[model samples]
Target: MALIFLYIHVLCLWLCSSTYNAQNVFFQPSFLVTRGPSVTALLYGNSSNIILILQTTSPSNVTGSFDPPSCVPEETRWVLTSELIAKTTVQVKLRLNRSLRLCGNNETDTDCCVNPLCVRETLQVSACEGNNSQASLIVQVKVYARLVSGNMVFDNKTIIQNQVYRPLGECPCDLTFKTCDLWCCCDEDCSTEDFQLFKYHCLPGPFGGQFPDPEYQCSVQSSQNSPDWFPFLCVISPPGNNPYLGLFYQGNKIAPKPGMSFGASVSSPPTLLDAYIEGSPILTLKDQYFTIPRTLNGYCVTSAPVAFLKNFDVKCVTPLQACPTEPPLQTIPEDLRAVVKNGVGGNAVVDVTDQLATELNDFITSSESFGSSAVVCENVPLALDYNFYWKENGISGITLTRTLGTVTLNGNVSLTTRYSAKFLSGDITSKPNSGNPGYQVGRPVIGGILNTSIGNDSLLIERSPMHLWKPVNCGLCSHADVRPVLFGENSTSGCLLPVSQLNLTQCGLLRDTVNSLQDGLVEASLVAINGHPNAVTMADWLNISYVTLNSSGVGDSNSSCSNIPAHLQIYVWTLVTGFVDEIPQKDIKAVEISYSLSSWKLECGGGDPVCIDPAETQRLPVTSSVTFIDIPLNTGPPKNRYQINFTEYDCNRNDICWPELAFPFTRFYTGEPYSQALAKGIILVFFFIVASVLGTPWRQIRQIWSTI
Candidate 1:
């Protein structure tokens, strides 16, 4: 017999979870200039009123003939802050949907517009502060566009990489015109000779533009072989060296000028589209657009926007510097606006309930606050729920609410915000069904225990118990949050339970509690048919795992309780059917449950009679998971079926013969029938016999036969 020993160790460390660029921001302008003046502007404040200051040096000659600068709105004034020898400073306050007025008395409109203010404006020092001392000092203000001529620009903002767009080249590596550049094979001026000499050593363009060669491989090993290999020559190899580089050329072959805006012209709020795109922002009823806050790759984004007819629930952790006084809809300007004015009458106003404000205030102030020394005061959002009623035309009404946790001073708050959006029909205002005839993908799965002990024919279904698993004191598991198992989603949740003094009495109580939590699912008698609980039949259940507990005796000094239930895993198998123009229907087919058990034992040390730290309590982790597996619906049977017998070849005379039936030779059989194969074999044999007999001499053939 052989003996084996195993050792296991566990370590847990609580660290302050922090991430970079958690908020979703559009157009992170990071300007880089090689040989030109550059200006940097920082915006500070909320969305209603944002202040931006620009300071740059002005050239003395201001009378250069150039395109006219864009006009600035009346509400936004560019005030001259300071005027020095050749430098000037100006400030402007920007607001959303502000009106604009005509500036000059000329009948021809130069800068004024019937629409909103232009994003690009050129303010003169004289016009801003009536200081005409420097005529050439015109301040060019460009928003969401490049402000300087540069070869490269790097922005660390969260950009949706899934968008389909043509890249406008800002850097041209081919500096020389009509001339061959050394090691620049992409240069159009380079001839075949120049290309051949520099092809192996071609350098990548600054903005990742390369020659359009679809078959080119940038790998070192691939370059070291034939076709790409240059014998006995060192070649430079860079990753992703392919023809389809990041370069996107314009049809006109003209490079965009500096300070050119690539984004769409924003004159007013965008109109509603037939269907909203995923990750694209929701339409703004007024000046504010609704953003679904979420975290991507561990960083929080304020605008993982909602897609029309697509339901979602996103939960993420974001760090807040201070506790918020107002609701998230008001504090975070990205939320959908609640109040709007009636366009008919200027004074007529449409009122909305302050549900978010009231809910958030109660959530924050109602929670228990801790002292500075006892509790760490880092703030994170608790939850933000959005319910929108939309019709065929557009969104009809919206209801928003927010919940915040404890707030502390000078403490970093780690909060988790769960944001969910469900769009209901404007006419149908009742609780939305999981599905019309089948279960929806994101909706909660319906499951419960059916009780028939009440009467002979009476049956009652009890809702499944849910364990609270909220984050407490920055811990991974807690006992405050409530969540459900959503359909088509596989998720695991657990809570920590502290057990003190694992004795027979305590173990018995734990056993009873776990059994109650199991809810007799292990011995379920029936199953729902097509996700319809009322329509059920005798279930053909398969037991994945059975819960069991074994103990030697009550208060047995040498024995301990083993096989206590510690985990429960639920497996739901659903049959998914496709529809031509409707949402996919998911119907429940089967369900399986598995239970895992744990044991309680103490370790003795130093030859002590009792266990070490026997009085200390242990935090045992209890977890449960629900996994959904989609089974493709069987679409009838095949048009033709193969034979059951392996030995018999039963293919039709017109059809191709079975390849495996060529038994003696286990090779692929040609499409030809056996008769044609035999005829070809006989003809080849006859020709070979004739050739051998005519080509070979009799004496040589006899000698070959004798040797064989």
Candidate 2:
């Protein structure tokens, strides 16, 4: 009985060992097979260490028989075999027979492939289902045209679909096979040698495939894990909203709905029926429309049409082919030609004439020809300003102003084009008012010669004498321009007067010129508002109230005692009569001019006893500036008043009653007060308790607590 029991135990152990080894032989969780359009393979297996070697065979040489009624050609026969190896993993590869005639030249031939370009064959492995550890698999092989990377080739024959539809569809950009595409690192056919060259050069995928989740791609070891393997473990995850699932399934396809939309909306150019409406395209002389030139994806496009009544300013830098000389119209840009053609006709209301075209051409060629030999004249258009005058009846006229500038050889030019459409009216040429009623800031101040005669009579006409001066040449002074002064603006202007000689006569003339310049500006009156067309009013006119001229001597005969105006400073006052809607209303009230004269002490040069002609020129710096001060207007009388009364204690008798008495805190207290009473009390109590508590012994504190 003991021997039989021992034999039963041994049988059970043997069966358990066999089951463990069988699980290891059939532990294949996944498999991969490479496929193509013409030649494809359909593989099914669950066991590991199984290799497949596929080879093509002719119809006569094939071992299988073809059924004529089914039209199955023997050239589509393929044999799949396995290699006996010691390794645990198996590798499958295809071996092509180049010498075999697999298909006929045309479709009419007997026992020929239906598709000349595409040939398909199937190899059934009936013996693959040997035991429970091995699964039945079918092998299919085919031959067809292969595509190259970056090049597109279209075949009309019916071929097997080689599309790989993942979350992202098949790489439309990766059209090549067995080669590495530039900036395409995700290509599977690329070897290690190809990847080493373009790994870092991979461009961002169109669907953001280049930037994938790092956790999925990175190989994380068990030792490198943090306190929590996933930091967002507690976070609420979103549902999978995959878009490709709607089109593809597990090895199957689902056609998308025809009504589904994708990408941006397409906008069509406006036609003649939509003329004068909002967003209507600009019209041209022909049936076409005006389009703006643009560049997109390294290609030039002229389809970006412009809209009527839409003002825009665009600037672009482009290369220019330059030379010393060219034809008048050759150098002209296409934009200029479009402007000239569209200057009339269509919506244009102006009367067309032959002279108009002539005038336009003449204006374009008005500049000198680029014919200079000393300087290479690479003239390019700088700016194009288009002003379209429009009314209710469409555009009345169009004016184009083109600015051109020369550039260096092999250089780029920047062109700015501006288009503006303005409404036309009878009063369009009239000047805009400075303000509604009161004088506005930055507006030109009204200034002119004032007549002081009581009766209407002509006075002695005086020379419109030069007053202010500005620098013309190096350190040389010239008469300043008569520019209108603006309100609320402080300005400074000056010049240098160079004197070649410093004799008594020249000194006298210099003194006279300086005095005359200062005197003329001193008497001028400036009005705060614009001039009236009728009678004159002097109520708001500003006159000089104070004048100061600083100098040591005034005798011009003494050459040594020379005094000339060096700097003049003007101060103007304005009255602000309150604000209307937060804007201040101001008017000029008064003007004051002050001058500083610098005297030159002449010394004899080169041991000369008396003053002689100096070889060096002398320069006197003259400067002038204006400053404005605003004073508020007094609208009413004083609001408060005080009357003096006598008291019993006078300031002389009682020191406390003094007008300039010292502050109470300064006289009564000599140092800082106890302002922080709460903080001081807390500090004092804390220190007292610490001293008392620390003085007591531990045994005494225990006894006290027991007594309590």
Candidate 3:
């Protein structure tokens, strides 16, 4: 029993030893594949004394192909078949052996595997084929793997350590494929030598079949730093508003509306209008108005009521030819003589001669007979005078003494005739020599004649019953009322109306006649002339026809006062004689004479009542004066008085005839004393006293001489 028991024990020990070896060989973790030193092991073992063998799965023997092959000897051996390990799971550890052989049949040769480089790898291995090690557990080893470090083979495919590899085929991680520095892609084919790596965001799968999401695909070349690809539109939204759409060419934003037309030479890129179709039915190039689409936004056509771009033009013209001209003056006709009969009133016959006559004839023939005619009288050298005359007839058998003046006519048959010149004396019978007498005398005066009968015939004279031409202090008969009468010869018979009716013509005939009647007087008194020294009464000098009228007395006798009528007549006669003797010198046809009369009141009384008794009555004495003078008919009166008379003398005997008369008296004072006797004595005594005084001086000298 003892021997048998000992045999069982020996047998049990051998069986248990074999069981331990088998478990350690098949299931022991041996090689480590780690990224760092012992931090994470790809394979871990519980035994410390296990041997590690590393190999590379890569076929290349380059330095970076895989890990270097290494052997780690231990007290115990950890065994693994090559079939159970992947070549990609092996790692190799290698060492530099300058004197050793790395691939040869000699194991102890000096230059074999001495470089201390090892590889470990985890790889995928193929099954062992026909003549390979099949008995005795012949394992096939693969040094290259997909992932490896040194010469170790890992059962798992995880890389336990960081390792370098020689990239094979077309490795994307190769340095030859690296894009760095300033290198750029120029082609769209990313697989070609000139292809560039592109970065693209995953977008909706539409254009180029790209994916959308977090994954990015490499397709076309990136537009960044590219010359051909440009940012066609860039719109930057405002803070709160829509983004601005920016269109760019060659990286610059193109203007939306360009001023200049396209296709024209420009220095910059085209505008936005050239690059885009903006809003709704965008304007296209096919429209009828789109002849020049390049100028689209440049000039847009608005709606109706279209405004033109600018302005238009204008023009003008003119004409050609010319015009015409005109003419001159003339002369006036000369004058000729023209005589018109009864052309004007009075002796106012106008003689039109020369130019005046021609004008007058033209005027007369063109005008009516009664209407006015321009009878032009030129250079009429003859002096024209209008003369007036009247006749006087009052006393019976009285003859008038008249002086006839000589007359001559230069043209036509003119004659001189003497009308009867009469004295317009007041009375000389009452006081034969009175100094002044109030009397107005006229000849052949019709309206103012005195009615009387001589023998069996009746006579009418231009005398009043009082023998005064007008009353004393008669306002109407004053100088204002006197006017001259004028006469003219009959054309055929050369006969004139009587001087009383000489004023019967159109030129104031009625006016002159009325004036003469109201203001004229006729004188018919006989003047008595005496040849005696003593004073004579009117009764003493009787029935005288003529007297020697003298202005002063002769031989120491004082001159006696003459009657006014007789003295005026004598003065007129003297003038007539002188005029007749000087007839050749006289040029006028007649002469005009004017006369006047005035009177004043007188009272004769003293203040003694008894010496000149109240019962004794005294008579008042009144005196008057008349004067006659000759003046040119045209000369008007210088001063006017109470009464006046006018008379005209006709030098032509061809009209109106009257007999010559001597001086005649017209008025006399009826009751008045003849104080000439007392007056003469007083005048003689006054002259004697004056003579004695003058002679006294001379006589005294003579007396003294005699006494001596």
| Candidate 2 or 1, higher TM-score | 1
Candidate 2: give the clashing pairs. 39-142, 148-176, 149-176
Sliding window of 10 residues with minimal summed lDDT for model 3? 322-331
Best-to-worst lDDT order: 1, 2, 3
lDDT tens readout by residue for model 1, 480-545: 244655777788766665554544236666666655554432334333433334422334222233
Q: Which number leads on TM-score?
A: 1
Can you write out model 2's per-residue Cα lDDT over 568-657, one digit (the tens) per residue?
Answer: 777767777657797877665666677766775445568654445454545556676778787867865653433124543345455566
Model 3, 29-101: lDDT tens digits are: 2233342111111221122233334223443556644322334222211123322134223222222213211
User: What TM-score, to 2 decimals, does candidate 3 have?
Assistant: 0.12
lDDT of 2 at 47: 34
Reference-based lDDT, each prediction? 0.46, 0.46, 0.25
Better of 2 and 3 by lDDT: 2
- TM-score per candidate, chains pooled: 0.37, 0.32, 0.12
**Candidate 2 residue-wise lDDT at 502:** 49
Worst 10 residues of 2 by lDDT: 353-362
Q: What TM-score does prediction 2 earn?
A: 0.32
Structural RMSD, model 2: 24.6
